[model samples]
Target: MSPTPQERRAARHQFGTGSDTPAARRGPSGGRKKPITVDAIVDTAFGIVEREGYEALTMRRVANALETGPSSLYAHVVNKEDLDELLIGRLCAEIDLPEPDPACWRQQIVSVCTQLRDQYLRYPGISQAAFAAAPSSVDTLRVGEGLLAILIAGGIEPQPAAWAVDSLSLYVNAYSLEVSLANRRISGSDDNWVVSRGELLRRFAALPETFPHTKRHAAELTAGTVRDRFDFTIGLLIDGLPGARRQP
Candidate 1:
């Protein structure tokens, strides 16, 4: 007789097939298995990224996880680049963008940045995927539209608001990637990073003849947590905004 549902589930689990669902597919043996869908492809891709860093994410890997061939994925995701754009869209589209609040533009901007950062942080190396993606996706456009509305409502000129959004988005993505890379490379021991950071600062300070500015503010420069530094930078960006043209 055929294997019971429980036995089939055990077989799927024993293989590399993911969660028990209709999406599960059987091998050449002709049994109940999940059908591959775009959603399933995306889910499998994320799982691979989480288990192994982004570098290990490939079509074959995801396909293998689904008990299917990589060609099966092509019907959904065209290639690695296409998959990346979809991945970014998948994450970005979920952000709950706030309606433009002229009176609270600054706060809104901060909240948006924080949300985007947290979203990307969940995937560890998602920034790499973001870097490779185009801005054509629905999700990416939504984010841009939301930020633009907020900036425009703040009495900012169109051009500078556009520039600000571009620059600010770039900074947040770049900063998130930098932090993610550091976390992956550093040991769990905080002492190592602390000592290494201090040593680098001291080295700069000792170079007074060659780097006067470095020597002058080493202590001050080293005085903040990562969040403090990020907040200070965000504050600077905010203060410089409301960049409308002055009346001649």
Candidate 2:
């Protein structure tokens, strides 16, 4: 049986497969399975990513999940790079671009970045794909367009606005990738290598006399939650934009 429209929408959000096309359904040994489509391939790939992280996503793995040979996936997805583009495209599609609000452009851009960060965090290590994927994908361009519009509306010149969009995107991808790596380290069996903030502070405090500043500001160095750091970095980027309107 094919998935209903509601099911497809749910899958798009949950698995980051933004296609409206229905996914293939597996059948019993005697019965025939539904025909596989591009949507089905992406859905299967995302399933693997959700369960085992992006590093586990492979053409053969997706083919196996869809009960087909690796060659079959090539018919729809040309290669791993193509598949990565599709995955990132799906994520970009999920981001809701707010109409340009000149008064709150900075907030709008930050909100979009946060949305993307949350999506990347959902499938750990997936942001790595975003860094590699081509920027030409339609969905990816849509996000760029929206962000550019927001920045321009906020009084930024076209040249700087375009560069700002790139900078913001790079930051989001890098930030999400770092978070995913940290989470993986903490969850892995070798988690003893992952240092706690308090331990870090203690280490800093124990530094040699040459590092007086580090010893004196150990607590400050180890301060703030992940969200706090994310917010602070984004705020710095947005606020540093030339001619950005300061909030009263």
| Stretch of 10 with least lDDT, candidate 1 | 12-21
TM-score of each: 0.80, 0.87
Q: Per-residue lDDT for 53-121 in model 1, tens only?
A: 687888888888888877666654557877787688778778889988777887787888878887877
Q: Judged by lDDT against the true structure, how good is candidate 2?
A: 0.82
Candidate 2 TM-score, C-alpha based: 0.87
* Candidate 2 lDDT, 1-248, residue by residue in tens: 65544454445435554454433344454146777777788788888998899999989899888887776566556578778888888888899999999889889988999999999999888999988554766778889999999999999889888889989999999999889888888888876778999889878978899999989988888899988999999989888889877765
Residue 202 CA displacement from its true place in model 2, Å: 1.1
In model 2, which range of ten residues has the least summed lDDT? 22-31
Candidate 2: stretches off by over 4 Å:
1-31
**Alpha carbon deviation, residue 50, candidate 1 (Å):** 2.3
Best prediction by lDDT: 2
